[model samples]
Target: MSQKNSEGKRSARERLQEQRRKEESRTKRKRTLIAAVVVVAVLGAGAGIAALVAGGGSDKKKTAGPLVAPQGATGKDTVTIPVGKPDAKSTLTVYEDFRCPGCGQFELGFRDTIRDLEAKGQLKTDYHLVTLIDGNLRGSGSLNAANAAACAQDAGKFAAYHDLLFKNQPQETDDAFGKKSRLIELSGQVPGLDTPAFRKCVEDGTHDSWVKKSHEAFSKSAYHATPTVLLNGKDVYGDQKNPLTPDKLRQMVTANAKG
Candidate 1:
């Protein structure tokens, strides 16, 4: 009886130990499953955030209505901000982005010469505003600024506002134009531009789609890079050997005019 009791006790202890081992194994599996689930959830959230940012942060793609072309739009893809007489003999097409520092440099270097030629009615400039910088830089500043410039076009203040945009452009990485209020504030500096309609246009992003269309055209065009200056439909800065200067621009325009 004593031997039988001892054997029974040993059997009970062994059963308890087996039960504990099974329970531990089950718990570990549950914990691993939970950890795997957590890891998957974290990865999923990160991917979603990455996608959102890739899609231009919070700026949703415009999805309604026919795109309203801004004032003086020569094509669905371009806004022809007339700098000189409509009958000017030569045409200077300038493709630029508001957020591009190189574009700012180009404008600072050649604005005077371009304006002088425009004043003389020797050349007409077709300003092709694009937004490539916004895509590369991961923000909506370029798009918003271009939209605001289009709004200025509606108010007949495109030239002044355009110059201001370039003149006050923040660093390449800085997205100062992301806010609609900033664009409107800049417009106030341009006399007679701070109107209710202009404000509504800027705030409402009235020309955002048109800006996108212009960028599409720019992307398809042969000339790459911001501040692409084409004289008589030929790239003025394409030739690195004969780099363009203010004097060179004037000479080219004069020569084109004579031709």
Candidate 2:
């Protein structure tokens, strides 16, 4: 073969190789762009899911309707449920959550004594119900139960229903009280409390706004825990060095009465 023909063949081969290299580079760029698009799509989907979970998880914080305080409710913003004679010499103030185990224990331990004192017209108790557990544990049990208890208050059966609730409280993790049916069922135990009005009140969440307001009040206060018991205005249950007991509470009330 002639030298020029050999050179032409070599030139043709080099051009073919160059074309293949360019094609490979284009293919690699396309794959990279597709992978980036897929990654962005996956990330966008994950963000959407996170937003949905956040929105659904905070049901207890949803805006409540008009505030409707229960019957005979007193104190600031009608947030207090007053028990015992108003003219009683001593006053016991309690801040509690319906689903809080500590509040249940407090009620179980000191209920009889408190009732006795109330009956004797020596003590008036102001109860402030809160829903701290619902906020902490991500459930509506505390809010629902508090609203139902307010309905009982309207029926003039607050004390009995309140004691009954603490007695029959479900496990802290269980949201049994979140069900209106469960609350209405418990109300059957209290005579004259299972009327149509009471049922409607429980189902309609009549005092939910009021309960939320009470919880807001507690949230803004200096205390952070439930079962915050006080004698008059002095913190009684928070003194770790001097724990408050049922007998001690009775003695204190008696002394206050005598004084």
Candidate 3:
């Protein structure tokens, strides 16, 4: 009886040990399955977020339009005027005085308008300045300024020099010659051009003939004002109350182009 009891006890102990081993293996398998599911969920979430970001980036690319500069003038030298579009169809002729307050106002107003229209090739203007503002500007005439301008034009940088002169004009005083020298000094600062050659040109009065011719034209024209404006070959500004409105200019430009 004692031997049978001992054999039964040993068999019961072995069965308990086997049961514990099987439970541990089952637990490990469940842990591995859970870890794999979490990893897959994280990867899937990352892919979705990346796709959304890419879509937003593509939309941003589509919404951006063409680029434009502050002053719409193509930085060219064809008209010998830096801030003008050479290809515009509606030709504008301005009889300007370098020292005239009205001329300054006209410059600011006209530049703003031309910027918008230049890109569309809708406006072309020729500045035929008269030396009327020079002598009296701080007590000197525009002859020196005109001489310098002619020089710049000969240097193939008339446009740049013209814009510079208008932009950096000094206050009216008794020293207009000083201002003239300063304007000429500035002409040397433009890039990729021969400054010494330009200086010689201005010194020699290269555009003297044209300046004289332009003065003759002004003298012969039906208008006589500091800011005498011709829209498509007819004198208009300095006579009208509303001289330089964008809407009116646009209308005139459109009509002139059509004609």
lDDT tens per residue, model 1, 1-259: 6999999999999999999999999999999999999999999999987785676534444332358888777744455556677888888888899999989998999899988999898989889888888879768889889988988888887888999999899999988887778888988899999999998887777888888888888889886798898887888876779889999899878987787
**Tens digits of per-residue lDDT for model 3 on 1-259?**
6999999999999999999899999999999999999999999999976764464221112121222111222222222233346667776776776666677677777766765665577876666656655434423335446656666555566556665666666554433433444555677666633476665544544544545455556667676677777776776675457665767888878776687
lDDT comparison, 2 vs 3, better candidate: 2
Q: Kindly indicate the candidate among 2 and 3 with the higher TM-score.
A: 2
Regions of model 1 farther than 4 Å from truth: 1-65, 76-79
Please, what are the lDDT tens digits per residue for candidate 2 over residues 47-160? Answer: 987775565332433446899999999998899999999999899999999899999999999999999999999999999999988888866789888999999999999999
- For every model in order, what is the number of clashing pairs? 0, 0, 9
TM-score of each: 0.76, 0.78, 0.57
Point out where model 2 deviates above 4 Å.
Answer: 1-63
Q: Candidates ranked by lDDT, best first?
A: 2, 1, 3
